[model samples]
Target chain A: MDAIFKDFGKAYAEFDGYNLAKTLAPVAPEAQPDRLYNFHRSTNFSSVQKDFKSKILHNNALPFKLTSEESNGWVEVYCAYWKAVGEILNAEAATKTHNKVSWGKVYEAWKEMTVVLIRGYTNSGFQAWTVPCLYVAGKYMRVFAIKADEDAANNPSSAINFQDDFNPEAEKNEKLEDAARQLNRMFQICLSDRAPLEESRKWGIYNIINLLFKTYFKLGSVSLSKNILKALQAYRGDMPPLDNFPLSHQVTFKYYVGVICFLEENYVEAEKHLTEAWHLCHKDAVRNKELILTYLIPCHLLTTHTLPTLALLSPYPRLQDLFLPLSRCIKKGDLSGFDAALIAGEDEFVKRRIYLTLERGRDIALRNLLRKVFIAGGVEEAKEPNAPPVRRTRIPVAEFGAAISIGSKETMDNDEVECLLANMIYKLVLFGAFGLRRRIYRLHMKVCLAQPYPPPIRRDFSGGTTSRT
Target chain B: MSAAPQSGSAPTTNATSSDKNADPAKDTKPAAALEEDDEFEDFPVENWTQDDTEVPGDNTHLWEESWDDDDTSEDFSAQLKEELKKVEASKKR
Candidate 1:
């Protein structure tokens, strides 16, 4: 202590009182001026009435009002919508519940909330902190809640009354091609009017489309999915990045295309879009990025069959904790463990395609056989017959194995013959037509066989076969 | 003439006043000029024109000082107008 004090004394004397005061003078901490908040007021029935007026409603964007209560109004609205959704669901005791939940009340709550932000800020001019989010949240909450309700009701054991939830029949919901068209038109409207107010514009057409995508997915509307693809493709006319807009919106053209790929079960294309979307998603937006990547990992695994281990995803050191478990489950072929990891991902709070167990579990289970084809020294190495059996390709096995992260070097040696042959034959059956990819895959087949076989992997489930053995 | 000397004046006062109040003849120690210059010397007019990063943080006043050479405000505004025109034109395309 004396040595340190002497060193400091030699360099800088202890600041005298006046000198220290000058050095540590108080910073002018910015004090925000008082803001006007609307509280203790009854719901504005007149404004809700005025919503239908010609003066307010323009081109299907019925302007609505949302009051900014001083304390936790946004969260309160969310809770309110949650209640509304639950009430509608509880009423389903007597009704036929076949399709996904409609969650009309929650959707209505979201719609009303958007009206609040649009009305309060864009029209009446209040601060646009998170009212728009309520709109998006309510919309998707409605979709997922409805879908969950519908699915729950349909299951024999967990059967809640479906008839009361909503009146739509499963076949009718599918048959109503026009409903999907209406969803497109709704998105078109969301995208149609350029928001005059920059803040309200956060709930841009892109945001609405994303909400619709999730909602429609929840409803199991394949028809809606196809329409979303068309709308997205058409909407891809160039867009300049808006001021203060997040990076996710920057690559949205690619995003919608990826959503389409996921629906079509093109795991490769899904991963391509979803990965870009996840990366392009704002770094601080903790939940949504996690949600998107949750789907992306499985897509990477499904298409490539390689799980990104802790080492690969370490740059995002925060998510590395979740990565290890998810990767472990996939590599070990522990379905339940994989399912646990899918839920265990740090971003369970966000509603997205990849993170949600409902979407990813079944998809991964079905796609594992497909992804197992391209391990570095594993499946790709085992069955090499035609070529001179080089030890391994000069193109570093690490280069090809880059995306397909397998921690166990032994996985390559474990089940080489079965996984590789399965990969080859599956490719032969599924994509052997006279296309460029097919031709390339044909070359890949020769390359696949020329590599040495791996010993069979210890598997509870059979590999390389899509069907039950 | 230099920004360093002008801001340097404030810290010099601090040192001189503290030392003078402590004792006048001992205050004749040239620590005021030396100590004051140590902190203020880093912020030089030479640095003002070098690069945006040299200023560090959001020192808008320093940035404004860097462009004080010929009152380029008008020319800068005109250039921005041109950029806006290009933005609008590209959107039209």
Candidate 2:
């Protein structure tokens, strides 16, 4: 057994070293000065793949083959898969010329090669390595496809000849979607107990799941994303510790889940996840940290009525630009200012799809308005001596309307005011409803009055909150 | 293209913690799955711009910066003013 393991290790190192040398080898200095050199290298790659298959294919004695033993054969498979794909990426980066080797043909071959490599790795149960490799490779494919599409769209050459109006990006999108679906299938395989879930492999699942979410987001397939989140949640028991993932994956996963929940208007859960992501993210990952906070600040406004402090927004200038005006309006109950800020930021918000989420901030403004009326209505005398004075309740809906009208340039009617109040009640920003009609709810002002700010997240759950699978 | 009323979310319902624990596998029936049309019912944005992924993660500044150039803000503000006017007009009616 010891000898077999040793032999596997030796074979893996030899295979990997040879591929690295082959991939890195500079084009022979002067062998082919013409463009035909690309063809020569392509032929060389085919011969190398053939030699690789003859040596490593169907070797029953390879370590970690059928039984649960360490096998060096996995590395050779990994290196070969990477070397094949790496050649294309490296060559693309080597020159400024686009489509020198015909992207259409290369992508078709890669589509085939990805399937074979994935199938072979899965059969051997070497998921830990294979999943991460595939995750990154999948990301590169998505990025490259997008870059190609952009190039095709912007390349002046295409503009010169309007007759060939074929859209290459349409094909690229289909290929990317196909690749995403394939990765999802492989992820399902990795979820089983038979695949090795060693520490490193455990972290790889986060990367795979995150990339899957990105793909779904890009596809704008919300139902598919929802299904994937549900699937991941159901398999929660099998996942590793949340701390095991790299900070980027942890933050990215929580951000997506939080944004999804916010879209569904599940404010409480969104607050929980976004808060955790904000605090746990690496402080140096400035942009990501800022992105998490952008969603988080709005979640806090909705759930707790707490505004972000100047101190909090100081470190992130971009976030401050996004949230400061909105927060100030929510604080002062400036309805017009809030609307103006939202409109000013409309394109940015719509692009991020946070317009709907932040639109809910209007509730904060309304809450502040109602609270002002409560304060101005004055406190009635306490029932007993040495008791705190209770604020007056049951202020007329007409009075709230007048307060709302002050924030607007146009006059507001009683029914418009009632409609606004009804919405407030429906959203649960206010409690106790005795009537709904021409009249708004008769309030049990105590519920609205009792220091309505939400408590801060407890320390125990802040940094260590595990995602629902 | 069917002119369904844009805002279709049935007023906010309390999100129960049970949603956290419900096993999704047991409820895999396709009919029960949330439909695309249903989810987008409350989506207020009429026109979605193309991919916002200029930079990998921090595209907020990209949108803001791009809109600053070439009157995007003015266009969106006009659209917003028009929508607000419709709401006001509806309430008056």
Best by TM-score: 2
Chain B TM-score (model 1 vs. true structure): 0.25
In model 2, the clashing pairs are A63-A71
Candidate 1 chain A — worst ten consecutive residues by lDDT sum?
A32-41
Tens digits of per-residue lDDT, candidate 2, B1-93, equal: 121111122232422232222223213311121112211111112122224112335423322211011222343234333444554465568
Interface RMSD of each: 29.8, 20.7
Candidate 2 runs further than 4 Å off: A1-46, A50-110, A124-131, A149-172, A193-203, A233-248, A373-399, A422-469, B1-93
- Candidate 2, residues A82-114: lDDT per residue as tens digits? 354444434443332323433333444455545
Looking at candidate 1, what is the lDDT of residue A145?
Answer: 41
Q: Which ten residues in a row have the lowest lDDT in candidate 2 chain A?
A: A26-35
lDDT tens digits by residue: candidate 1, A243-360:
2343444344345557568656787888777766654444444444445555566566555444564433655554566556665444432344555566666354243434543334
Going through the candidates in order, the fraction of native interface contacts each one reproduces equals 0.00, 0.00
What is the DockQ for all candidates, taken in turn? 0.01, 0.01
Scored by lDDT, the top model is 2
